[model samples]
Structures are given as C-alpha cells and as structure tokens.
Target chain A: MKKIINDPFNFVDESMEGILAAHSNLLKAAEGNVRAIVRADAPAAHKVAVATGGGSGHLPVFLGYVGRGMADGCAVGNVFSSPTSSQMKQVTKAVDSGRGVLYIYGRYQGDMMNFDMAAEDCAEDGIEVQTVLVTDDVASAPREEWQKRRGVAGLFFAYKIAGAKAETGSDLSSVRTAAEKAVSNMRSMGVALGSCTLPTVGRPTFSVSDDEMEIGMGIHGEAGVQRCKLENADQIAATLVDYVAEDLPFCKGDEVAVLVNSLGGTPLEELYILYREINRLLTERGIQIYRPYVGRYACSMEMPGASLTLMKLDDELKELLDAPAETPFFVQN
Target chain B: MKKIINDPFNFVDESMEGILAAHSNLLKAAEGNVRAIVRADAPAAHKVAVATGGGSGHLPVFLGYVGRGMADGCAVGNVFSSPTSSQMKQVTKAVDSGRGVLYIYGRYQGDMMNFDMAAEDCAEDGIEVQTVLVTDDVASAPREEWQKRRGVAGLFFAYKIAGAKAETGSDLSSVRTAAEKAVSNMRSMGVALGSCTLPTVGRPTFSVSDDEMEIGMGIHGEAGVQRCKLENADQIAATLVDYVAEDLPFCKGDEVAVLVNSLGGTPLEELYILYREINRLLTERGIQIYRPYVGRYACSMEMPGASLTLMKLDDELKELLDAPAETPFFVQN
Candidate 1:
C-alpha cells in the first residue's frame, strides 16, 4: 500500500515505457510490439540470438539482460503473469539472425506454455528456435522429480553461459546445450523473512508471523517446504547450503561459482554476512569457489529474503562466466 | 528487528570478513589493520591513490568502490559511525604510491575530523594527502549555505570523477580538483516512506504515519524539509527534480548524468516508474542526459526510499564518466 505508483492496472505498460525511455541507448521496443524489448542493435548477422521472457516485477531479469553480450531480446509481461505467445513471437523475430534464436526462462507452467506456442509459430516461419527451461531450485523438488523444480537465481548462470556461447557465433544447438548444461549443474534455495506486496493488490502475497521464516519460498511467494522460527544468518545459510549441496552432490575438490542473491528487500550488508557463512561452510567441505557474486541478481518485489546458488563449473563454463558482459543491472569486465 | 545477522555489536567486523572473503580476488584487508580494506593490487607506482571511508551499513559505498580504476582503499567503521583516525592512516599508508593519495568522503563532522587527523599523520610520515568533502544534498541547507549540506548518493559522482582522474596518472592536486569540481556540480534529494533499523538497536530510526512521507530525508534518517501526504510517483519525481534543477540553476540544453538510487527497500520496478517521470521532466526542460544509471548504488540499510542525483557535465567530466572502471558492485567498460 506504500508503493509509489500511479495506476495499478497500468503498472506493467508504464514501467516498460519508463525502462525503454531511460535505457534508450541500450534497448528499444520491438518494431511492432511495445511488450517486446530488444537490444538497440539486434539481429547480428550469422550469430545465434539469445532471448528470455517472464512476468514483470523481477527487474534485471527478463528485460534488463537484453544487451550486446547477453540476451538479444526479451518479451515482457504483466506482474506475476507470463507474456502472451504473440509477444514472445515478436521478440523472437526481432532478434533472430541467420543462425537462429534460443529461448531461455524459468520453469513455470504459464511461461512454458506461452514459450512453446511461440516456438511453434517461429518454426512455421522457417526461423529455428530452441527452448531451455531452468529448473534449479533443489528445495522445490526431490532428485527423482528434479524437472518439477522451479527456477530462481540459478537462471542467471544459464543466461551467462548461453549468452557467451551465442556471442561466439555458435549454432542454435550449441547455445541450447550450454544453457541446459548450466541449469543441470546448478542448485538454489531461499528463505523469506517477509512477504512482498503486489502493486495491483496493494497487499502482501502471503504472510508469516514476525518471529517465523519460510524456507524454500518461491520468488512470487509460492508456498515453501517449511515455515519455522526465524534463525540467525549462519543457521539459515547452513540449511540452504545443506539442501542445495546434497542435491548437486557437490563434494570435496569441486569448483563452483557462488551467487548470494537478495530477494529485493534484504540489504547487501546482510547478504555479505550470509555469504560469509556460506563461504565458511563450503571451505570446510573443501569446495573451491571460483568467483562469488553477492547482490540482488534476481528478486521478488520488496520481499525480505536471500537465496544461494551454486553452479558447478567446468573450464568452459568458467571461461563463459568470466566473459565480458554489460547490462543495465549487471556488468562484468 | 527482523534482520539476518549474528551478534549485532560485531556486525561490522563480520560483514567485512564476508566482503573480503567474497571479493578476495579484487580486494584484501590491509596488513596489521583488519578494518582497512585495500585493492589486492594496490599502490600502483606513480599513480594517485583515491581512498574513501565512512560509517558502516551503506554497502557499495566506502568499501565497494575500492577496486581497479575506482578507489584504491577504504577505512571501515562501525554502523553509522565514522572510522577512527588510526584506521584512516592505516588505509592511507597501504595505498599511497609515490604520486600521493587523495581522500574523499561525505562532509560529516566525525568523518572530517578523523580524516584531518589522518592527513596530518600521513604528512609527518612524508606522504602527501589531500581531502575533498562531498556536500550535494540540496535539501539539507539553503543555497547560500550549501557547504553545510550533508553528502548523500551524489558522492558516487565525486568518486567516479576523482578515480578516473587518478587512474590517468594525475598528481594529488589534480585529482583533488576533479573531485571538488564534481561535488560542486552535483545535487541530490530523497523522500523516505519508512525508516531503517540498525541491527544493534533492534528498532526503526524514525517513524512516519502510514499515509505520510518525509521529503528530503537524510540517508541516516535525519529530518527532512517537509512532511506531507504520500503522493504518486509522477508527482514525487516532479518535486524532487524541480528542487534539484533549480538549486543547480540547470538551464535548457545542459548535459548531465542521472542517478536514480534506491535506499535499500524500494524495488527496481518502483524506481523505474520514478525514473520514467524523471526522464520526462528532464526532457520537457530540454535538458540532455548524457547517461543515466539506476539501481541501489548507495543505500541506507533497508530504508524504503529513493534519491535522485544529477551531475552537470563538462567535456572533461563527461570523458571521465565514460572511462572504463571495474569493481565488485560497479563496472563500466
């Protein structure tokens, strides 16, 4: 209810308008569809195009990643709602080069359905399109049902690997393979200290007692595995890491990239504190951290929580992760 | 308080440990001084060193800027408290190359006094040191008493300009001049919807009615110029921009760099909506925005608010702003 917004009904459209205006130099609306955002210079000849899309609310996710070295375009949607198939098709067409286009996004029912429809449409037009669904939240499912897990911060790893492969002029199949590999090697889990409010609803999506925390909650306030008394940073880190590490079976001598992501409302100071405990636990297990990123890479709007993602890295994955990238919300050199 | 921290009294030390552990590749704690953080590859021969320090809780400030082509070092302090003179001297010594060091921080009494003492200490040790106090919060003082205003998010402009100048092998005096010029050209103001809580205090710093907002609130909950009914994003943006523009006397056709920074709890979606209106207002005034950066660049631990900073640019400042720099939290390439 305390949000600084104009009209709740027009939140998505108005937010996209603002984004396009502010990042005019780096992004533009698709020629015929304002819901689809593409890099200003898209369709680089003979290079595989990378595209992703999902609901609004998570900035730097679907749209913020559309840039020179990242996704070539993204289809945007209403808050907590997937973009329509038509919007996806428009973005796919806008960014597709002679090589093809790769579609990557979190594994949600609405998202999968819309993206599949768009892929079929693109195929009819002789534009090759492939899809990769990120399912890396270990707490969302058991190993036997890993494919049923929801994606979270681990999608960032998929984006980086796929974007790097496509930027190197790889074929569509190669980009898809890289993305799938990254997702398969990753695991994430989160604890929510508080809930986030939707602009339209003007109320929290869910609620918990002041002294309680929800473990394994989804980015959009999906019911988690358990709700328990609030614990300190070290305990929370241990619970998250224990679940994720066991799921991946990350063992001694394993090398990985660590992402300690805040869920919108958590401060960087607390994230770093959480990261400290995560680092200590990983070190005690003899796992090597190749590169650690601590910040709000992915988030739910105004949710007080944090997530930990570990992506087991091979030499190729490490190289791709270290490749130069520039975007409005993320930058690496 | 609903914070994920252990031992609130030791929050600063534990957070620093995590930061050092996470960014060990780019940074390291100064030898014999755990509170002093220096770039891993510090003391670049014959290059002016840029150092900054302030109270804790504001991540990405004070310490996050200490990396290649940004800041050479920083002195860490307790929550909302300035670093001691000994801490400042240790960091200055750790990063001082033959070219000397330039100290930059917010214009706060404790910070200024401690840094001045450190400067004298460095002088006796035969190390050249110059200081520039940032004062860009237009809401804190009248135009005739601008020097008394508190520094806020606008300090980031001073850091980027001075760091770029220092990286160019400029001497101490030249770097100091660039920093001073940047601070003079910048203006900022913020509105707070809620207050922030310190870990040790376990309570909000201040309070506001549910339907009220404090305009021009300081980063640390200092009283603002006005309190009124909370307005929509468009109206809020207009008030902030109008005040900042008039304070700078920014004329039509002027070029500037815009920073729409979050005070921790404001989501990017809301910030973008705010930015949308900011862009519209500036465009209507015929002001040319050179480049706009939007995110939580400087924050006050989970405070629900946003600040707008505009730095009028000259040819030199523009070039410096465009220069390449890399840090854990910020990167331009």
Candidate 2:
C-alpha cells in the first residue's frame, strides 16, 4: 500500500494545519487540546450547540459536515481511534452558547467513554451537555437488541436533523429529540470486500480472498458477520439489501430513504448496480421511496464493500432534508 | 482484478438489469438500454426536465445525480464510453414533458456527437433540448486554449447549476445559461496514483508504476500528461493545485469552490490529507473558498488519484448552488 505523509503519526497534524490554513475563511479549531474543527462564524448565542466527535478516517462525515446545515463543531482523533474526553469537552465548551449543547455520535466503547466523560466535564464548566450514541448497524446485534450495534453511516441522517434543528435556533432538548428521531428511524448494514491499510500500519487491516466478502464489518479492522466467496452484483445486492430491508422491516407502503454508501474502495458503478437491485426488491415489496443516496458517505480507507442505510423519514426530517444545506461534503436541495 | 459477470459484453447489460430491478420504485432505464435512469413518474410537465448523458463508470455523476434537485434523467453508456445517439434520444424522449429540457453533460467527442444527435431527434419529436458540455480539465490543454480539453468532474458543478435552475422552473435557455456559466468558470485537473481495471477488459486501462502517478489523466483511463514518481500530499497538491490555480488565474480575494475528487480507489482519509495541503497553498495566495468538496464525485472503478476543481463563484452562481435539490449522490444548500 502507498500513502502520502511526512510520517504516519504526523499525517493528522499536517492535515489539520493544511485544512485550517486553506479554509481559514470558513474553518478553525477550538482553543486547547481537542483539535475540533468548527465554523469561524459560529456565533455566541443562548442557543444549544450540537457537536459530534469520532475518529479521523471518516472525512466529511465527522468533520466536513461542520458548516451551515450540519454540525456546529467536531472533535477528531487519530485514524479509526476515538478522541480523548478532554478533546470532546473542549469543543463542546468552544461551541456552547449557554442554552446547553448536545453530543450526538456513534456508539463505540472508546467514543462512549470519552464522550460521557466529556459531557460530565461540560457540566462542570456550567454547560449542560447531553449525549446520544447512535447504534444503527443492525448487523451488529439481534433485532430486539438493535441499539447494541455500532453506529455507522446512518449517523449522517441524524446529523441532518440535528443540524437543521440547531440552525432553526431550537433548544438542546428539541435538537436532541430531532437527532434521536432520525437515528432511531435509521438502520444500516455493511459488507467488506477488501480491508483497509492503516497509514502507519502499512498493511491490510483485514484480508479477504479476491473472490470473497464479509458483511457487517465496522470502520475499524473488526471482523464482519459473514464470509463468503464474492457473488455477482445481483447476489451481492440481495445479501446486502435483504439485511437492510429486514432490519428496517418496511412494509409495502412504508416510506423510507435509502443510502447506498461505499466503504472507499467499492466502485460507484458497483454502488449503482447494488442500488438498482435494492430498489427493485423494495419496489417488488411495495416500499415507497423517500430519498435515496448513492455515494461514499463514510469510508474506511480503501476498504471495499458497502453499507445500506434506510432512514424512516418523518415530516420534520422530510422538511429539513429538503431544506437547503451547504457543507464541505454534502450539498442538497 | 476480480469481477462478477459471465461475459464481458454482458457486464453492462446485467448491471443495468440489476439496477433497474433494485431501484424499480425510484429509477428505471429505457427498455433494452442501460443509459437514462429516469423517475418512475416520468413525463413531468409540472417541472422542467433535466437530462444529462456521458460515459459510464463515473458513477453518481450522470445517473445517480439524476433525482430530486438534480437531473430528471441521465443517459449512461459503457465504462468510459459515451452513450449512443439513440440512447440519448430515447432518454430525452422519455423525460421530456413538453416543459423543455436542458442537456447538460461533459465534453467528450462521443458524448458531443450523441447529445447533438439526440437534441436533433428531440427537436423532430417536438421536444426542446438545449445542450452544454462542461470542459474543465486544465491539463488537457494550456490555459489560453482551455476549451479544447475534454470535460471531467467539473460537469458536477454545471449539473448543480442547471439542475437548480430547472428545479426553480427556469426555462431551458436560462438553465442552459447557468450550466454554461458553470462550465466556463470551472476548471479541473486529475492525476491517477494507479490505474483501474475495466470490468470487461479485465486489466488496467493503462499502467503506472507503483511509485508514480499519472497526472492529468482522463477519467476514462486515457493517458495523463506526466508519469512521475509519487510524492507527499503537499507536493501532489502543489502540482495539481498550482496548475488549476494558474489556469483559472485565481487571484487574491477571489472566492472559489474547491473540490478534491477521488478517481475511485483513493480513500476519504487520503483526500482530506490532499485537501489539507491544497487548501494551504490556496490560502497562501489569498483565495477565498465558498465551500470545499472532498469526496468521490466522479470515479473510474477504483483508480487511485484525486482531481482538483476550482470554480470561481459569483453571487448568481452561489445562489443557484444553494437552491434545494436532492439526488442519489449529493445534496447542496
């Protein structure tokens, strides 16, 4: 594997320096240790500021989403590693405007421990902070225990709702409610055809035969649920879409938004092929399409395979999603 | 180099069948043709129908971007190959609701021929279709005669502008004007760190050394301007950004939208590292950024490299961009 960096460890710092410098007009990091990227225009108001924090590899999702229509701020750690609690707290302090702040992020032990500690520290700073760890990856757990799964790409849908609520000057509770609604209504399943090579590790994170794939792999180098020889696009689609459709359990007339996300290495051609099959199954089942997204939403370096996310859209979400949003990563009508 | 297909020629057909079946609820292609994925509720006279067509494999760009705030229909051809004139005409005829349509797409010889022919066919069919090709790859030619260079990912910007205008009920001419403005103002340059294997050919469209990248390569596997040893992200950014900046003559205080697009195999982590450096160089020159997009907008089936697109934006362009639009690929404020 080849990569560009002064050193594996220096990669993040160098990136941080360059991103701040280039987007100085719009982006900046909060003072102190967290290295959270926040909008330069983040204002001081008595409004609840919503913040998210996670590892660094998933660009645009954890950080690039920080802008007018998304996250107010984000705390990032090393590749596939969780940020420190202090870092998370520092960003919360920087973006907090007195109405309190909400911490919404994926559910991971490192993230949960760090964010919970950060929330406690925020209270010590005289700022009320609440957190909701999104656990939308249905493949990670049984249906009745859905919340035990890791939060994957579906957090993006939550961000949209939370960001819009915050943008509307909603309070912390309201923002959190909207975000939680989005998260609760969302379900995701992922497959890995290839593994990622950590920049410093300089080897594959996991290995798969050229003719096999693993479903339910996390952003990290975790093993997936299923390991089977690669099948044609149709079968691949069936395997993935079945999981998604089953997890979401959408009825024939149920409306749901679809997100077909690539985990970095999968080709967009394949993504569309996958989506074509997914939609076919949904249609044959009489599902109503709300919104469909086909792209790389959250990725694990060059890891192949994809994740399918189905978000049960509500009126609030439909309006907010349809609302204009402009971020470094996503732009929507 | 593993692929899922029985026969080389059947790859495209099988993939399309799977796609149409999957997205049956929201997307459908013209019978017997893989190009032109249209909304099931076609013949939309209530809104201006937007049509775009180009080579395949640059996923989500031409087809996935064809929903909600994006194109009403898209004519996708073979990998790196343009759709036939009949395909374009069929798509136009399917999407045209007598509301007039705008044909916005990339500038490629094959696409130019087919889109033109399709427009003529649409004209004979009593449907109005205006065409505009986005030619922005600076490396394709020198700045003084930039028009000759073929189109690349810069077409995404044109699609947004035209899509937004059409969504706003703007006439075909006005939408075409917006798209043309975007094409004229935008400039892009791409480099491939490695080559991508075509599905049918089952081999790299071309080859590059493991230690080198092909700078300014066509998205369709065309040769690049240079094949130099790969350098750090900063140097790579300088090489691509310097050319794009110089070509566009982005001056101090000029507001430009920066897009760091992956060809296919590059990771978001890598793109961020690349963006960090690219932005740093631009900031030093005092260029203001409206927004920066870092993701896989147009890809070539896992080819590794990134493209830098600089679009000098004015108020008019900015507003059109912020208009509400939704597609399977990107949503913008």
Query: What TM-score does chain B alone reach in each candidate, compared with the true chain B?
Result: 0.99, 0.95
Query: For candidate 2, what is the DockQ-based docking class?
Result: acceptable
Per-residue CA lDDT of model 1 for A186-285, tens digit only, reads 9999999999899889888888888999999999888899999999999999998998899888999999999999998999999989999999999999
Please provide, for model 2 over A137-254, each residue's C-alpha lDDT reduced to its tens digit, 9 standing for 90 to 100: 9777888888787899987887887888887888888888888888878888888878888888878876788878787888786777888877876777777767877776767777
- DockQ of predicted model 1: 0.79
Stretches of model 1 off by over 4 angstroms after superposition: none
Model 2 lDDT per residue over B226-280, tens place: 8888888888889988888888788899988888888878876677778887877
- Estimate the TM-score for candidate 2: 0.84
For model 1, the local distance difference test gives: 0.90
Query: What TM-score would you report for chain A in candidate 1?
Result: 0.98
Tens-digit per-residue lDDT, B72-168, candidate 1: 9999889888999999999999999878999999989999999999999999999999998899999899998888888999878888999999989
Best model number under DockQ: 1
